[model samples]
Target: MTKYCRYHRNHGHTTEECKALEEKIEELVRAGHFRRFVRKDDNSFRSHHPPRSDHRCPPCDSRHGKRLNQPANHDPQPARTNVTPVDPPLRGIINTISGGFAGGGSTSSVRKRHLRHIQSINHITHSHHRRRMPPITFTDDDFQGLDHQQDDPMVITVEIENYAVKKVLIDQGSSVDILYWATYQKLQLSDTAMVPYNEPIYGFSGEKVSTCGYIDLHIIFRDGAQTKTIPIRFLIVDAPTSYNVLLGCPSLNTLGAVVSTPHLAMKFSSPSGDILTIYGNQRLARECYMASLHPQLPILQTNHIERPPSSEIT
Candidate 1:
């Protein structure tokens, strides 16, 4: 009697000798399931039949049945593309310009155009250098009523925010206008009206003080028939001072003013082609000077005087 194979169900062959079973084992090895048929004694599948020499891989159509020897599903190298590098038009123009200056085969029209462009640039630069401001001059009438004997600082009365403010000092040395905190409070301005100012101001005594804030006010300066209205930014500082407000270089330059200390008056050319003059308040200047000296005078007296006066009196 012929015994049949259990796996292939074919007669005349045992399960170990069946060719179909051998092919099934090779398929399982290619599919990564060869571990299931491995024996626990040797840790490997022991087949009595030899491996097929002409077996083809299912994935890559190669002669090797192992999956690792098969070719990859994707192409290893990327497809080549036709790409060309390009130069900018500005580069071409620059090359043309350099070639023209280097005495190359450049056209006369191109050379003439480049020369004209260069000449235009030189003409603009030359015109800027030639520009000049006319000299400023003053006449004898500019100092008509000025008295040098008064020897007062340039103090004037100006109208600010529709309020007549006195003790306004014209300080050419200062770069900004300043409104004393006390004077600003006297104007009855609301606290919300001031804008924040972070800049510090230095005084003549080399002392630095932080500003409280600033406010914009319409300042009206009158000189006889001439009057100029300007918007002034005043930095408010909480410091004791003789002057209520200080008119610095910013306001003076805006009005095109010229200050003469010897004359004790400020003169400026009005828009109406007339020279307007504002004179200093001699009496008010003296008063402020005395007030400024009062605080220091007491300190000086206390420091210098001694009890020798009582001994001299005895």
Candidate 2:
């Protein structure tokens, strides 16, 4: 069945569902054209309908300039109970807007602009108390376990899915986290679990490194009893690398970790709000660098020295 809009004098949507008509009605109401239709009390019309207490507009994605569909199970923002009474001008305009507007029916650029204008006028901002993280400062004692003589990268071990993954290099300069093909195979992760990533990453010499895919894995950063587990999306690359995984800026920043090369340690806040420092294996770091130079050489494995307690530090 074909529907026609008499307002537009065209086929497709009905006259009642016509967006242009609704916009025109809203504009006329705002201009005091429909003074008789608007009730003397703006709250009277709203009291009966009570704008569905449960309904909420999905958060706007600034990048896309559109509303993203959220999952059914997704937690919604707390419904604002202390909503201020709408101004007469806005209430009059709202009275003319079709029921569709309230239920996300019409999403024209004009509608968006009008809604934004209304939101700006009646926006309620809720203030939240932010939890302050303890100050992370590296002292000379942070270097007690390391050999500062060698210019080695920050290489350490992090647990992945409960497995102690060794030869993980913490590169603060790297933008993306990387998981080598050899390590991926060792993890016994199904290839189907990998989400396809097409963008090629460039190396120092402008060489393109082909990516297999990317996977979000929970990696455990531990310093004795203090542990921080964060999900990291590691780009799987079929490249020759001595390191099993490379921890980059994305994960480091998320974990609030600070890397000090001179100190040969990575420090991040623990769940208990105390600073937990993970000391880099200086011996393993030099070995990994040497292995990178000699790809033919077998990857050397070593015992991961568990970081000593903070009390033991001088």
The prediction achieving the highest TM-score against the true structure is 2
- Clashing residue pairs, backbone N/CA/C < 3 A, model 2: none
Model 2 scores worst on lDDT over the 10 consecutive residues at 93-102
Per-structure clash totals for the candidates: 0, 0
Candidate 1 clashing pairs, residues 3+ apart or interchain? none
State TM-scores per candidate: 0.50, 0.54
Per-residue lDDT of 1-314 in model 1, one digit per residue for the tens? 45556774444345555556675565555445555666556434546465534443224335755544223453223223333334446633211101111221136776577667657866667765554433345556556444656667888888765566677888877756888887887777888999877656666655577788889888878886578888777778887777788888777877778788766777776666676778787767776778778855432111111112223211
User: What is the lDDT, from 0 to 100, of the residue 18 in candidate 2?
Assistant: 55
lDDT of 2 by residue, 66-115 (tens): 65543435333323333244566543321211211222222466667766
